[model samples]
Target: MHIAQDDIMQESYPTVLQLYKLALLVPQSTAVVERGFSAMNDMCTDLRSLGQQTLDSLMRINLYQEELLEEDLELVVDLFKNKKERDMPL
Candidate 1:
């Protein structure tokens, strides 16, 4: 049997194409996601739920911890220390 290149090219292999696309989307490992979850679990508890923004910020700080040094920490502390407190209205 002889087949032309055009015939092969024109064939609609939707299933194969879709499977290939999905394969590309699959992660090689779930370790990173699992690690993040583990960190979150350690940081939070059943009795205390953090706000979404606070959780996200804490996650980022935890993730990039290796990049932060003692000086960086002190600077962060200093900034918060110097920040003005907002007055509460009755």
Candidate 2:
């Protein structure tokens, strides 16, 4: 008796392969989120009353700039200093 040799692949779970592929593609790290939270905690204190827009800008800078150069910071400061004054009527 001679057994015929045929190469055949059997997928026990069809969806498992797709799910596993997706799982591999997704980011497994929460470091960026954690860092943002940490930065917010550090930056915002009871004494500091930061507006929503200001806080958002600060968070963006903190999260993106790993090492900000002094010249870049000076430029930022100059821009803020020379920013158009909003005359809010009380």
Candidate 3:
């Protein structure tokens, strides 16, 4: 007597399925935006001066690559070493 969700969606609830698809497509909510602002506040202290582009890049890395931030600095530095010829040590 149990019907699968896909079967139910296909059989008699096309409108519901369409609504569900639209809901999935909706953009992220305000919490993400608030988190971005919070990150900006934390990163932009008085001692450090950053250009707008640099600030944006740092904020993005802070917010999205949080887990990567927890990793070892040497491993992260190694990634940049291969990208270009460096005149000085990293």
Each model's lDDT: 0.78, 0.73, 0.77
Name the lDDT value of residue 25 in candidate 1.
91
Could you tell me which 10 consecutive residues in candidate 3 have the lowest summed lDDT? 1-10
lDDT of 2 at 81: 87
Candidate 2 CA-lDDT value: 0.73
TM-score of each: 0.46, 0.51, 0.53
True-structure RMSD for candidate 2? 11.0
Better of 1 and 2 by lDDT: 1
lDDT of 3 by residue, 13-59 (tens): 87777787787788777898898888888888898878899998998
Q: Put down candidate 1 lDDT per residue, 1-90, tens digits, no spaces.
A: 322224453376656655666887999999989999999998788997999999999999888887876549889888879989856778
TM-score of candidate 3 against the unseen true structure? 0.53
Q: Compose the digit string of candidate 2's lDDT tens values, residues 23-73.
A: 777878999789889999888899987889999999988876856654488
Q: After superposition, how far is residue 58 of candidate 3 from its true place, in Å?
A: 0.8
Clashes per model (N, Cα, C within 3 A): 0, 0, 0
**Residue 55 lDDT (model 3):** 97
lDDT score, candidate 3: 0.77
